[model samples]
Target: MLTRHFLALLFLLAFAPPGTCGPVKILMLGTSLTQGYGLPPGVEIPALLQAKLKAAGVDSKVINAGVSGDTSTDAASRLDWSLADHPDAAIVEVGSNDALRGIPPAETERSISTILAKLEAQHVPTLLLGMKAPRNLGSAYVRSFDAIYPRLAKRYGTMLYPFLLEGVVLNPKLNQADGMHPNPAGAKIIAEHIFPYAKALVRKARVRRTAK
Candidate 1:
């Protein structure tokens, strides 16, 4: 009887469903737009994402790895350290600063590509948020910069959320006084837009965990 019970217990443990062991960890790697900028604590994109996951009954933790003023290059530098937490998935949101700085689009592409490659090696599912260069940068620069995200996302086989700001950018009502960075309400809109993709990532993570 004791031997039979032991075997059953082992089988149960081995087949336990994903998320039963613990909450899935999601890494949000990005810039000030991701950091929540002037917004107070608990109002950033990561926080908003966490709340949504919980409300939807998905057991998950969103790690805020955002750094204000960070460009794609900066994000690339810290990716290995961020991956130290061993996130089941990640959201890449950098590049706005790179555009603002007029960094060559190729350089921005290389940095973002590096980040995606590292994430792929770890087998972590990723959702990349794209950014468009300011119109003032002229048609040529805009064209080059905007092309980077989709190209890299395709190359890396990661999910893509075209235009991070989407409905929030250029609307005075949505931006902070600096005409950049979303206000609280604006942040909510972003959270709503990204929730679907993030949820999909969570599901993918759970599926991968179950398969393992």
Candidate 2:
């Protein structure tokens, strides 16, 4: 058994590509929803995603950099700190607060673009999660805000999950009392929806593990 274990280590050392670190750190940058808001511990979006990924056989540590009430601009301002972990990949989920606060879509676009640029420069794979503007925000505002994610994704050549809240938004059972943030049950669904895109990010992050 000792010799077998030693051989395994030797094999890995011989085959593993030279890189700063392995593809195991996954950072999630977002707001209250990812922070769990009113939900209990270990039930937040990032946490649930981590669990899901583990179940899928992708062992990763998800860094939940979610700050309640954070807007896209706010998240952008802290991008450097968030990247300090040197994560192999990142999930960009801010902008919901910006939409709720009526921040200009162009401003949100610029902030998110900056974040994507920084991540690209660092060679960290990123998955941008989209959010739709409130109905009361009017058609024009809705159109502008709703379009930012795809535009930024195209510009940055990053993966985009069209709508983060997809099947959970506005559903009473899936949301907390506030109806904005998702409940634990809702978070599971969201994680499932984003899993495919996240898997792509993981695959990209793992490339460094084998590439010279």
Candidate with the greatest TM-score versus the true structure: 1
Error of 1 at 12 (Å): 2.6
For residues 44-88, write the lDDT of model 2, one tens digit per residue.
Answer: 888888888889888788899999999888899998998888788
lDDT of 1 by residue, 175-203 (tens): 89998889999999999999999999998
Instruction: Flag regions of model 1 displaced more than 4 Å.
Output: 1-11, 14-20
User: Which candidate leads in lDDT?
Assistant: 1
Give candidates' CA RMSD values in order.
2.9, 2.3
Model 2 Cα shift for residue 92 (angstroms): 0.1
Q: Each candidate: what lDDT?
A: 0.93, 0.88
